[model samples]
Target: MDKKQAQALGKLLRLSREKAGLSGRELADRSGMAASNVLRLEQGTIANPRPETLKSLADVLDLDLSDLYAAAGYIQPEGLPSFAPYLRSKYSGLPASAQRELETSFAKIAAKHGYDPNGPQPGEDETE
Candidate 1:
């Protein structure tokens, strides 16, 4: 990651952590990272963190992993299967009420289309 990117990521991490109501030490404990490491990352002292580290932070901070990956300089190939980045870019910034409304609409659409997001996966037994 470049300097600007690192700084941007740090700012995002700090903002997300605060929004999640977690202190740096609390976030580190939840994410399984060292408190000092979290501080360094938040301070932009660590330019590039490992992918797993980023994922852990995202999970703890309730952030989208795709966003972190993009911030850390990972680019998806053209024609790739994932649409998470596009969806996040389009809707992630919406207010909570708007997001909940959209989510309800999407759920209705999925049910109408016979798609059950909670259904068992292909490899799983339908009966639990």
Candidate 2:
């Protein structure tokens, strides 16, 4: 990874870990990495980490592996759409109440179309 990309990835990793309520040591333990390694990765001291290391870090940080890969200057895998950017583009300018209203309306429409996001597919048997 280039210097800029590595720095960005480190920042992203730190943010995700904090958001997941994991300390550096906790994440290192979970991901089977050394605590110093985690700190160096987060501090941008290490560039071009192995893919497996990034994957393990993503798993422990509760982040998308593809996203971590992309941030590290790798190609995003095909057919894995990252919705976060799309969501931000579509909703970032809207007010909080408007965002909630839009989300509720979309949910209602999806429900009317037999889309139960939290439930099994329409034709799937739950017992299977």
What lDDT score belongs to each candidate, Candidate 1 first?
A: 0.84, 0.82
Name model 1 segments beyond 4 Å from true.
80-128
- Poorest lDDT segment (10 consecutive residues) of candidate 2: 80-89
Query: lDDT per residue, candidate 1, 25-72, as tens digits?
Result: 999999999999999998888887999999999889888898998988
Per-residue lDDT of model 2, residues 22-70, tens digit only: 8999999999999999998888888888999998997788788778889
* Model 1 TM-score, all chains together: 0.62
- Error (Å) of candidate 2 at residue 124 is 32
Listed in order, each prediction's TM-score against the native is 0.62, 0.59
Per model, state how many residue pairs clash. Answer: 0, 0
